[model samples]
Target chain A: MTTAATTHHSAVLEHRDRFRPRQAAGKGHVSVRNVDIVFDTHHGPHTAVQGAQLEIQPGEFVCLLGPSGCGKSTLMNVVAGFVKPRHGELLVDGQPVAGPGPDRGMVFQQHSLFPWKTVKDNVAFGPLMAGVGPREAESVSRTFLSLVGLSGYADAYPSTLSGGMQQRVGIARALANYPSVLLMDEPFGALDAQTRTMMQENLLEIWSEFRNTVLFVTHDIDEAIFLSDRIVVMSASPGRIIADIRVKLERPRQAELLTSPAFMALKRECLALIREQTLHAFEQQNRKH
Target chain B: MSVKPGPFQASSAVVPSSTGERGVIQADGAATETVVGTDAVGAAVEASHARLPANWRRYLVRIAALVVAVMIWHLAAVNDLNLYLRFENVPNPVVVGTEFIAQLSSQTFYLHILHSMERIAIAYGLAVVIGIALGVMMGRSRFAEDIILPYIEILRPIPAVAWIPLAILMMPTEQASIVFITFLGALFPIVLNTVHGVEQTPKVLVRAARSLGASNAAILRHVVLPGALPSIVAGLAIGMGVAWFSLLAGEIISGQYGIGYFTWSAYTLVEYPKIIIGMLVIGGLGSLCTLLVRKGCAPLLRWQKEAGRS
Candidate 1:
């Protein structure tokens, strides 16, 4: 495919694949009941997510897991206060979902590091915006950079660093805000296999220590099985939750768990559900044809 | 299709520096090549010969070119190459050089230089302030762009000297009119370029700043301006050139003292060498201004150097 055509296809597929709302988020609490996401594309109303309902407790690492084209990201946005659901109430901290605030930190798939900013400056940006003094904000940023194993890279520009290094800066930037909950949209989806594995382990290590309530979206069932305390599986087309598996694995889940029979078995089960969703999607496409 | 004897691995790589040395001496006069191995990141040395930093070498070349030009002038003047031209008007290079030196030491030339410099200083100051303000404003919002771009484009096509009549009508004095005209010349290029630079700042850069929780003002200062720095410096250099052009034009039309005024005065008296001197002085001053601005921007844009190394 031509590059422009491919990009256009990806963008269209992105909108068809994930739900993005046009309006600001509202609130009562961060709860979604029968939420539906529909977009008016050139092909008419493209239903991204339909009837997705989930309850996330405070300090829970919940993974919204599904196959490609599933609107798992749609559900994450609903909770992050970026999307206003068509037919549901979303809440955070016992209040309805308002527009994005410092209370919820978001780490994107791409690091999106400011090329002009040094690592410390990029990390300290939120605190600086919130009127924190430079010296204090800097100290906090340094601590977070150290946590991410990028302490020496504090003065480095994102452009100078590798993709993995840049993403560490992104994580540090979000964590420096000390948000109650962290929302990640496939933060390691762009990394190579080795880097992605390293990042996943780093993320789990972070979760074990801070235990920040996380709503992560990913297509990798293995990753969901590895990182999540519970996995929320959704189906595509007009998206809906096919399964919600509670992972009752013990605390301090290490990378070693990934090789265990138990983790593999869980991954197999999740893969079965995603495969079923893919089959259903094909059948649906055939029906339309 | 090969494994061990793959084309890339088997090819003998000619190192760029040696090739470049040959290229500099050859008729092509370009940097021939620079060897780049995969992931062989190296420290940045100075600019290549082709990308050589403008230095005394360039000025010396300019001087050599000037000497050649002078010799030609002397030849043509003495030999009467232009058979159709009148004899009384043409002067030899030596006569011009002697006259130029005498003028340089005299108060008459210095007064003109002072006058031109004063006009440039004032107009350039105003141009920078207005251009930066307009540029930043135009850059920030699409609405401002829609309103400003059409007007800038329309006025840009109209030469700064074309506004002289209008300036004369509006302003009471000749000095005011000349300064106004000069300001018009400097202003358009500065604003146009500044606006272009600021608007062309990468959207990704702005988005990165936004995600970092930066205020709009902070984004403008830290991201937008720095991102646009190279272009802005380019614009400043171009603006100085335009300012110099305007200064000469203004003096030509209305000035008691200045290089342009002196050149025009010499032309009326048929003094060809003094006119040449005025042109050279203008060229020198313009080059100096550009060099100063370039030096100022170099440290702030160290990434440009890093980019070269990589």
Candidate 2:
């Protein structure tokens, strides 16, 4: 299925290849070893994630599926080097996760594009910071902008773009550095149902060509089912990987296949696991209150 | 640019080069042009038409208000009206107008205007430089804030006028003293406003820039400075007004040649008409200077105007 999709989408592959980041140092192999994250609150120390362990192979599409406050985002942040684990080691491409770097491209939930910059500059930012010359950076931006189908909005500011377009620009900005891994924190969570569905499919199309590792954090089981090659369901509060389910769905999964028997079977299993975890979490919160 | 940033913007996210969604792209293209063309043209026309008559009306009302004020002043002065309120022997509009026209032709009048303008230009320029630097430093660093804030708080309340005696004693010359006073007046507003602006910058923006691999210096340049600009400009506008206030006080007290000096000398000589002319000139120049400051700052703040969020 993957091979067929590759042949079928060779045109897209050409465009994606032309615009891929200069240093295609594709080394997105993430290793999380006994990761524990704690936050200081007024009440006391609160464990967000405890003894979390996972291994993500380079070029693999994976989703950390869980209920909100389950520390999925915290774990992702640890990989992105925004949050340091209180205890344990996080390695990306055998390098220690030290601080936020261009090596891991991040697409935030709110499409945190710099509002002051034009769309082109926003995409150019990663390359520019990595010491790319101004003209080269601009060319890099133009290529990626074209790849994201936002070639026309090069001069337009981010505030003027729609939410989805802004997120697309965000993706373009992140990918401009040719990062080994893309950390998306519910990139389409704010979109309407149709747009979210469309975004998921569009994302898969981009992913197919680039084949960069993706650690997509989301609570939506359908999104996980549709996008990921592997679904890692996290348990509620003090998040840990409870179940690591491999998705057997074929590549270039379409919206129509969302209702297929195999797809529904996988969705049903994820739904039950999430429902059970969510219910347990709710009860725990009720007792605390 | 014709793209409508609507919810369906996601549909455009579909690769047109890809085999699927060609019909959706064509449909979106035609619909977008129609919507953009009508919306842009209609909004432009409506905005211009709405602004034109209102602007004309404002100018006319302003002219009428000035005329009425002059008329009331003329009547009161000519009739020696309000004698009980001690408004007697005040210069009438005609006398002041005549004197103003006569003064405009005199070399001394031009010299006075030039001297006042030169003092303000030098002092205000210096104030802007120092104020912005200090403000940004204070806003960016806790150490700078702690060190500078106490002195600022102590000095801000002490009016520029109150600084006159100390300024005269400390400076080498009277001109230096007057310029120092004017600089002091403009400094506070510019610094305070800049600090406020910088501090008010969104934390998310800083984080976003950081995550994008920008260093601290880059974040300050790309994020904090632009974010803080609108407030800094507002501070500069206010600073110009306060600078003029101090400029007048400085000129009146110890000026060798300025509008304020002319007005003070007129009072001493009992040349009431000349005093009134000086007052009018001073008011005109003060407002003109502030208008210039606002205009100068406008280009730097184009992002705010273009946002059209309001």
Candidate 1 at residue A289, lDDT? 86
Q: Rate the local accuracy (lDDT) of all candidates.
A: 0.68, 0.78
Ten-residue stretch with the least lDDT total in model 1 chain B: B21-30
Candidate 2 has an lDDT of 0.78
Candidate 2: what is its chain A TM-score? Answer: 0.88
Model 1: per-residue Cα lDDT over B89-116, one tens digit each: 6777778789888987899789888888
The CA lDDT at A221 in model 1 is 77
True contacts kept of 2: 0.27
Model 2 over residues A96-140: C-alpha lDDT tens digits? 989988878999997387766889999998878777788878877
Error of 2 at B306 (Å): 1.7
Residue ranges of candidate 1 with Cα displaced over 4 Å: A1-30, A38-46, A67-87, A277-289, B1-74, B83-93, B200-208
CA shift at B209, candidate 1, in angstroms? 3.8
Best by lDDT: 2
Error of 2 at B155 (Å): 1.8
Q: Which pairs, if any, clash in model 2?
A: none
Q: Tell me what TM-score chain A of model 1 achieves.
A: 0.83
Off by over 4 Å in 2: A1-22, A275-289, B1-7, B10-51, B83-85
Total colliding residue pairs, candidate 1: 14
